[model samples]
Target: MSAAGIGELREGPLHAAVKDLLAVPGDRAEVRVEGFVIDLVRADGELVEIQTGGFSPLGRKLDALLDGNRMRIVFPVPAERRIIRIDDHGEVLSARRSPLKGSALDVFDRLVSFPSLIAHPNLVVEVLLCKEDHVRAPEAGRSRSGRRRRDPGERRLVEVLDSVTLDSPQACGALLPEALGAGAEAEGFTTRELAAALGVRMILAQRIAYCLRAMEVLEDAGRRGRAPLHRRA
Candidate 1:
């Protein structure tokens, strides 16, 4: 289903590409209210915004729109990515798949930039796992003083593989990996313990801990040296 006015304004290709998948029947897109243009308004009157970039740009818009409004933030994290390099003449040169993989925990990297927004009562965050195509101009860089000045490449939306929603504290709690099993999460754990158990660095474990804490899914248990102790609430 297509939303009215969605195609009227020029939005990024990825933004426009995602609209068709998310908008249901009777949903309005690019709707203007009180001089602000909202991304979409669902049949249930839920405000939906797809942000592919940083949250710093959303503060003013969200503050105005979120008051007494049920809003959902749809964020896409690339699970699999393929790179397509093209020549200046737009000729396809080469295509290759990237080795890096993404998981739901990756959202914390972006979420950490603006963690406070996740705690909003009227907000629901939907993390989408997607496969994307990164289009690049392979021979586009220029040399200046033995330095490479590169043109910014582009990304295209390929597909959304799967999704998970965090609508409440408990929902956020559910994202904890099996490494932190029910007993472990409930029994309290130190960052060292979490890092050692997950085979991750202490810094990574700390970021994960911060995300859970901001979401109200985890709380302080105590401290183990510089690392903080936490338990699932």
Candidate 2:
């Protein structure tokens, strides 16, 4: 098979590198299974996929494979990012550290799009924490404000930092910020309370609740004033 896209999806440099780093001696790369081009099929028959972006795109693969196969979806999160600007000739113009620091909890932000996937026993989502270089090149024109435009170029993995795997509902629930307390004491948190506990905006807290609820880790406990309360299931 070619080093082409998996199931017609193109692979970026970062995607390819992560796969190479994660593959073991007995693993098979770019194998076709059930009409899907899986990233890796372990010797033990577990399917592994590397997704460098959002979870929404895994819909088809999950729908088809999660029924009978143990599939692991690896999502790479740039825990530390360095922005590299390149000129027309691909020579580096400048490089700087990005101010945005990512947390493992960021997996919840993306999981909001496919919250219920965690409920699938055969599916495991692994958040691969990595240091990355985000390369960019000049675009055709400048903005209305006279600032130069840059294309969103490919990302290159600098180093593998750590990883967090979510294979069960309990694992998903453990991602909750510790400020919410633990176990029984963490129950009855409204979105407002969840937001405060998580130190995030109300919208993100709502998304977190939606994901946790779909995973069956959190259940409706009743209402506190206007906000609905949730408790550990």
Candidate 3:
């Protein structure tokens, strides 16, 4: 990216790094085709879109892209995060790694945002697990030597430590605490039970439930009190 075009790119360091990694043997970046700017286009015309956010926002863009291209959407998960803070005086404040790490299961959080899109034959969801460095700028109005409440406030990607892929729905089974049954499924589970089973937060479990349900990995089996129950589909 050039100095003038730097602002034109919507993605951050993680995205750009993954794009380079995903650029296949004969793929090209920033290709203009049919008046649309594609991320990467393979020699055989397959397109790749690296999305690190929710899929719901890309509905219209996908609609346009899929009309003519067989595409794949790559999502990067911060499996490990390291924080680096900088003060207004351009001094490095602190560097620390987050104790709690993310996993393949974390993809469920974004998948719940637009579940049906993954069902498209022309589109595949690729999850990339990555170690990252987050750089933050100091919050405004604080004295150079004074202690601040939040410290550096605005955070952005400064580097990518490493990244690897978990491609296809089959590969994502590692995220589940238990395997989904093959048949119409005899027993069902709720978000609460799932949270307890996985030893994760209830809110995260809810998102995982939504993704599994959408993927046809789980089926709705009425409700347990106010929450919905799901069985293997």
Q: In lDDT terms, which candidate is top?
A: 2
Q: Model 1, which residues run further than 4 Å from truth? A: 1-10, 113-116, 139-151, 178-204
* TM-scores of all predicted structures: 0.81, 0.85, 0.77
- Best TM-score goes to which candidate? 2
- Residue 33 lDDT, candidate 3, scale 0-100: 62
Query: What is every candidate's alpha-carbon RMSD to the true fold?
Result: 3.8, 3.0, 4.8
lDDT tens digits, residues 1-233, model 3? 54225424676766677787778788878776665666788899888777777777667768787766788778777777778778778689888997867766776787777665666667777766677676776545546788554653423444444443444444445566544332333557777877887777889988877776776777788886897788766
Question: Candidate 2 lDDT, tens digit per residue, 46-117?
Answer: 999888788788789888888999999899988999999898899998899998877667788888878887
- When 1 and 2 are scored with lDDT, the better candidate is 2
Residue range 150-197, candidate 1, lDDT tens digits: 645666789999998977666766766665736635667887777777
Off by over 4 Å in 2: 1-9, 138-141, 144-150, 179-187
lDDT of 2 at 166: 91
Error in Å for residue 184 of model 3:
16
Clashes of 2: 0
For model 1, name the residue pairs that clash: none
